[model samples]
Target: MKRFSLNQATTRHWPMPDLVAGCVRAGVTGVGLWRENVQEYGVERSAALVRDAGLTVTSLCRGGFFQEPTWWDENRRAIDEAAALGAGTLVLVSGGLPPGSRDIDAARAHVGTAIGTLVPYALEAGVRLAIEPLHPMFSSDRCVVSTLKQALDLAAPYPHRAVGVAIDTYHLWWDDTVWEQIARAGREQRIACFQVADWLTPLPAGVLLGRGLPGTGCVELRRFREAVDAAGYAGPIEVEVFAEDVWSRPGDEVLAEALAGYRDHVAGPG
Candidate 1:
């Protein structure tokens, strides 16, 4: 329960104030926020609200879409927002290949270069950039960096403090090599964030929202948790499910279920 964090995406429709109050009531000391929600609620107001409630902003949702022409300006703004919100980490979703181009290698290289450009700004803002590798299914349109190894390779050139990796179970659960990579991340001190979500069969039509709460699907949730712990990552474990059914319920109910799942499956005695 101590390291549990309810990522804002788990309850997408809940208002910021209501979400903060519900987390406080549930004794959840940490939360992972989304840029859209923070901007809509006003960054300063959101910051103060969470601070006054004694909640920690575990990590901000995203700052990378290097394919966009405005990537520089947009990421800079994201860094500023994270700084104002007192978030120590900003997750980066390396965008997919450019239109009419299928060079995945080049896209990944661009992502590395882009992060290198932002290292100075991110360091100055006191926020770490966590490169998140989405599931390979999203390689064509969402994120070209599809494996933990690829994310690590991209981060290798930068200092761990300025650049690291976000390990999400939903994305990396299918890889047998992930265990070794997890250890490498810890050894290199590049584990900026750790998120949990189950992989469900009969994926939803909109694959992006196909994630399940911990213990609800086939992922070896406890094994992943123990592996990260053994790898020396003592950070918040954020449950970042993106299911429509979960989002349709009341925020409090969803939060309770998430906590139960985490306790029984991810954080329980091994």
Candidate 2:
């Protein structure tokens, strides 16, 4: 439980103050925040609120979408926000192929180049860029980087402290090569963040919000946890579920379930 974190998206409708208070009441010391939520609540205010409550902002969720024309400016703002929140890592969901273009190779090349452009700014801000590889299902419009190898490849040009990869179990669990890539990430010192969400079948309409909480689906959560630990990662394990059902519950109820799931599944002894 010491390393567990509740990502805000897991309970999307929970108000920031309520979430912070609830986490404090539950004895949770870490949280992964979403930019939209922080912006709505006022970034500085949100930072102060969390800090005053003695919670660590685990990682800010998202500064990628490199396909946007305004990506450069937007990413810089995201880095600044992360810095303000005292988050050490900024998660990047590298946007997919540009409109009407199918040249995946070129799109991926562009992502690496784009990150290179932001490395200096990110380093100066004291925030690490964590490239997250979404599942292949989102390859066309969400993220072109569909595997850990591709994410690591993109991070290769930058120093590990300036850029790294986010290992989310929900996305990488299907790849047989992930274990090997994870070891490589550890050796390269590029495992910047670790998020967990179980995979449920009969996926919901959009599929993006179909993730299950730990122990609620088929993923080998504990194995993934053990793998990252073996690979030398010592960061918080963020539970980032995105299901509507999970989000509909009260904040405290959802948090309790998340903690229990993490204990019984992700961090449990076999």
RMSD, every candidate, angstroms: 0.6, 0.6
Q: Which TM-score value belongs to model 2?
A: 0.99
- Model 2 / residue 79 / CA error / Å: 0.3
lDDT of 2 by residue, 173-212 (tens): 9999999999999999999999999999988996998899
Q: Give the poorly placed runs of model 1, Cα more than 4 Å off.
A: none
Determine the backbone clash count of candidate 1.
0
Error of 2 at 185 (Å): 0.5
Question: What C-alpha lDDT do the candidate models reach, one value each?
Answer: 0.96, 0.96
Task: List TM-score per model, in order.
Answer: 0.99, 0.99
lDDT of 1 by residue, 24-123 (tens): 9999999999999999999999999999999999999899989999999999999999999999999999999898998999999999999999999999
